[model samples]
Target: MTIREQLDALSAERILLLDGAMGTMIQKFNLSEADFRGNEFLHHTKPLSGCNDILCITKPAVIASIHQAYLRAGSDIIETNSFNANAISLADYDLQDRAYEINVAAARVARESADRYSTGAKPRFVAGILGPTSKTASISPDVNDPGARSVTWDELEAAYYDSARGLLDGGADILMIETIFDTLNAKAAISAIQKLLDERCSADPEGAAAGRYDVPLMISGTIVDAAGRTLSGQTVEAFCVSVMHGKPWSIGLNCSLGAERLYPHVAALSEIAPVLVSAHPNAGLPNRFGQYDESAQTMAGHIETFLKDGLVNIVGGCCGSTPAHIAEIARIAANYKPRKIPEELASGAAAKTVLSGLEPLVVDPAVGFIDVGERTNVAGSRKFLRLIKEERYDEALSIAREMVEAGASIIDVCMDDALLDAPRAMQKFLNLALADPEIARVPVMVDSSRWEAIE
Candidate 1:
């Protein structure tokens, strides 16, 4: 069945249980981070291979086994073991070329697992998971000044297109774009996928945009570091306005925080996107060793808030989570009825999210002009000038960081000289800006007088 059909069938009375942690489970198989990172080497040999060689890549059977375990545990929706199946993250292992093959394999494995375990009960859904590109929106320099960045829409779209096609080809029930921090990247990915679907539909003789061919899309963000804002400095309200376009089948929070920390975000999200308020928080905050100490029982206890507050329609796990945790959450979710949010609360929350496209100008209540620094504009200004002149991009980045700290809303970049290749310099700068959350939201104004230089 199509994803929309499945969503239509879901209700607050019945909470959807998404499967738990892939990376955590994979670690149990005794794979080191380096081994998983080695999957990057396969990019040249096979563009379709996953970098997590210990799990979904080298050992497909393990991934299948995990899916079966979750199904046996009674999960309503088993996310495909493809959260890192996107090209962006895989590029670290030099597996950028194999994005399509790896993603397709990931989806197929999950679908097979679900089908093999099905009996008289309802069929479990396969959610195709799409994560952020390697260039984090929260930390990229270009997020503040796009004109100074290296990564372009064309580049990002090309990568996502491959991954999206792979997932669709493998029959994912829904495209779950998760952990999005930058609204622009989210928009670019969704727009690219929609464009592809539209083209395919237009090519059809019957003009029928029917079946799984038109799979539903879900967009979720990670409020990991920020209280309620993404790394791009997008408040929950601003993010909703920017990324809510095309209307995702579901919209909510995931990653970066535990259930307690996620409460306010979920509460606000449910009010804005009442259709499907999904959440997959970490089992709890990570210990110093970066491990989750919470048990399934402990995690399940926290989920009661969702049941009582009616702030969630889908519940699952993220980092430091497991199938056992999902089992408990699912069990409780099955028994508890979700409360309906009051219309007043929901309506007021929805109104605040309406955003304007004009540049976000932060005029401090204390100081009127805020902070604007000129050091932001030099492609190789004194610091960048030295860096670019000496071909020291790494050093130039340090300068960018200082400029951001000096209160530069928009950095003026001029990388047109012999040492700085405009496009590459811009892409690099943008990637850096977008990765840094502090200034990722600042709007950039191009300072180039030449049209060619600006382009």
Candidate 2:
């Protein structure tokens, strides 16, 4: 069945059960460096011991066994062992080139296992996990300069595209960008996924555009400390606003803070998120030795509060969780009903996500694009500059008016030129254009080359 149909069916249930930690379970097999190597890189110098994603290709049986354990524990959805499958993360082990191979192998293993365990009542699923790379996109590597970043936007887009393509090819039912410390990185990943969706729909080799990545999408972020914000310094609500544009099927917190510690942030997010909320907190706070102290039963009890409070629709364990933990979570979740979406959101009244003063942008779960016009730039348009230079304000205003008529949700204005008085020109044009009802409705982007003019 299509993923949309599966999501619809699952939504009617009290809650969906996501499997527990992959890294935690991988540690169960007492394998050394050579076991992780599995003949893929026997001659390589770098240590491949912690690179679990490679095991999906080198030790397929081990990965499949993990999936089966979760399925037996009653997990409705099993994420592929592809969290570090992207080129950026794999680069640490010098196996960056094998990104696609690793991701495809990982998904195929989970898909096969999920299919084998499928029953008529609760069919299993595979979520393509897009993990945060080792490097932060928004922060500067050099402490001296704050603006200098380690990774560029294009690099992130390419990395995400490679991972998404691999996951979609291997039959994943959903794309979950989890453990997000940076919202900018998540946006880059979401943009790549959206581009893949658009390309599939527009470039149909066969008669029908029915293709891969048509699965449900979920976005999960991490709360770093008691301050209740991500590592990027965004509060839970800010994180929600930053990612809600992607229209995720589910949005929640995972990793970082433990289950009980993350309760307030989860409750705060549920109030604003339009879609179903999910949470897969770690196995409580670590002890002095840096090990999870909570047992399977103890962790499940903490998550029970979220379910009873009607704050989440999906629940699971993160670090230090095993099949036993998942089994208990699945048991507790079955008794409580899923969090109900607000009636206004369900009835088509969106929470007013307005961009550029125009009508509110309808952000549906499946939408992938938004258009904004930049023709109002005097720097780019010689004719518009000449019209304004000639003091014909009315004629120059026509340019701005025409862009809105052509379906631009937002208009960009740039009055930066070496010869022209940019501040005066910008102020004059903005006052005139904003006064017109036709141009005033949409939002405006003030694009100026000079710092003074921008201010």
Candidate 3:
């Protein structure tokens, strides 16, 4: 069935079952982190390592095996192992060209696995997964830091499109946009997916009505810190406002905290949308040894608690969760009576913006005038480079924030270096400025006299 149909069915059913961690399952294969991380290029097929994004590239067979295992264990929905199939994540390993290949293959792998594992009894669904970029949230302005760093929207958009297309092409039942901390990126991803769906629909009039795997879209946010807020400092309530605008078939939490820790957040989110509620938390905090020691039984017990209390519609594992954990969850889940969810939710303004998580750098939508200061431009001054580096971030963020704060809808950033790393420094500075939560979502003016800097 298509994503929309599956979601419609879910609303009528009791609860849905999503699978557990692919990475942890792959780790049982004994592969190193680097090998798993770089699998797309190397093309390792062994099951020694955990399930990595490379499966979408090199080791698709392994990815298939894990998906099949979950099906055998009784999961209703198996998430495609394409979490890092986006262009940006691929770029880190210089595999950007493979974004489409990776995502499409990931979906196909899961599809094949679901078909192979089903005993002709219960039906299974495949969900295409999208994860966040690698950049840290501590530097983003939306998180209230304004100092957190990131990449530009244009750069991110191109990547999101490539990945989204792959998932659509490969025939996924749902598009699962998970582990988002920055709301803007989430908007970009969902918009990218919608754009792809639109393009596909536009491409073939008959197919559009037939709903060729035009999957239901699901958006999930990560509450990373101890406070249970996103890196953008959005409370659960604030984040829900942004998510609801997307009109996802379902909305909930994933990654970041373990199942036990995510309890309160998941409960709160379920109240907002009449859609299905899902949570796939990590095993627990990793230890100094980088080991996630939480047992399947323990994880299942916690999931049981949540399930009994009516806290979630679907339950699974995240970072530290394994197939065993999935097995435990499957066993416990079979006993519960399915609950019904409402088909329609209270309507409101649809979210069209591609940026949501950060506070907009106050811009006077009516005018554009930003300031620039030179506090560290002295000869032979190490402090100058340090401060220049700092100010570029500050200015990018502050101006963006100031623009956001002052109500200047647009801002211009200029980098002058009669100083050092004029070109490189300016590039780094502007990149951060553009990425700053304040300006990360806004347009930027890269003012550099050096032609090289512009390049």
Residue ranges of candidate 1 with Cα displaced over 4 Å: 32-50, 53-57, 137-147, 205-209, 339-353, 356-455
- Candidate 2 per-residue lDDT, tens place, 310-392, comes to 99989988998889999999888889999998888666575565342422344344665656677778768888878877768
> 3-45 in candidate 1: lDDT tens per residue?
5775666653477778888778876877544444355433444
Question: Order the candidates by lDDT, highest first — what do you get?
Answer: 2, 1, 3
RMSD of each: 7.0, 9.4, 8.3
Local error of candidate 2 at residue 78 (angstroms):
0.4
Q: lDDT score, residue 275, model 1?
A: 50
Q: Give the TM-scores of the predictions, in the order they appear.
A: 0.74, 0.79, 0.72
lDDT of 2: 0.83
TM-score of 1: 0.74
lDDT of each: 0.70, 0.83, 0.68
Clashing pairs in 2: 356-442, 356-443, 357-441, 357-443, 358-442
Question: In angstroms, what RMSD does candidate 3 have relative to the true structure?
Answer: 8.3
